[model samples]
Target: MHGYTQDKDEYAARLRRIEGQVRGLAKMIDNDQYCIDVLTQISATTKALQSVALGLMDDHLKHCVSEALTEGGDTADEKVREASEAIARLVRS
Candidate 1:
């Protein structure tokens, strides 16, 4: 199974909450809500997504990368590369 399987439900719940926040954002725009208020909500949503990404990265490193390291071969190298790429993407975002 995947490394995130254990926390899959938590991730799904967070995503659902973020989805609702996005919908609310759309409504605020449609209603011509204050610009600053909308911007604040957008920031909150962005931070929530970042939080989820960090949690997933931690789970990946703790479970998948750790397991690959124990094996000590090409798999370990690939996992390290994969994790590095993931971190790079997160940083770019």
Candidate 2:
């Protein structure tokens, strides 16, 4: 099973909230809301997404990475590499 399976409901809830925020943003644009206000909402949306990404990374490290390490060998090595790549991508974002 996936590392996120345990908290899948929480993740889905968060994504749903983010989706609502996006729809609100579209409405703001349609209403010709202030530019800075729209930008602020966009920033909030970005931060929410980043929060989810960080949470997923934490879960992966705690569950998937730990399990892989116990197995050792090629699987462990690949998991480490994948985790490193994920961290790099998160950092870049």
Model 1 ranges with Cα > 4 A deviation: none
lDDT of 2: 0.98
Cα TM-score per model: 0.96, 0.96
> Measured by TM-score, how close is model 1 to the native structure?
0.96
Residue pairs of candidate 1 with colliding backbone atoms: none
Question: Scored by CA lDDT, what does every candidate get?
Answer: 0.98, 0.98
Tell how far residue 57 is off in model 2, in angstroms.
Answer: 0.5
| lDDT (tens digit, per residue) of candidate 2 on 3-44 | 999899999999999999999999999999999999999999
Question: What lDDT does model 1 reach?
Answer: 0.98
Which residue pairs show collisions in model 2? none
In each prediction, how many residue pairs overlap at the backbone (N, C-alpha, C within less than 3 A)? Answer: 0, 0
- Please report, as a residue range, the 10-residue window in candidate 2 with the lowest summed lDDT: 1-10
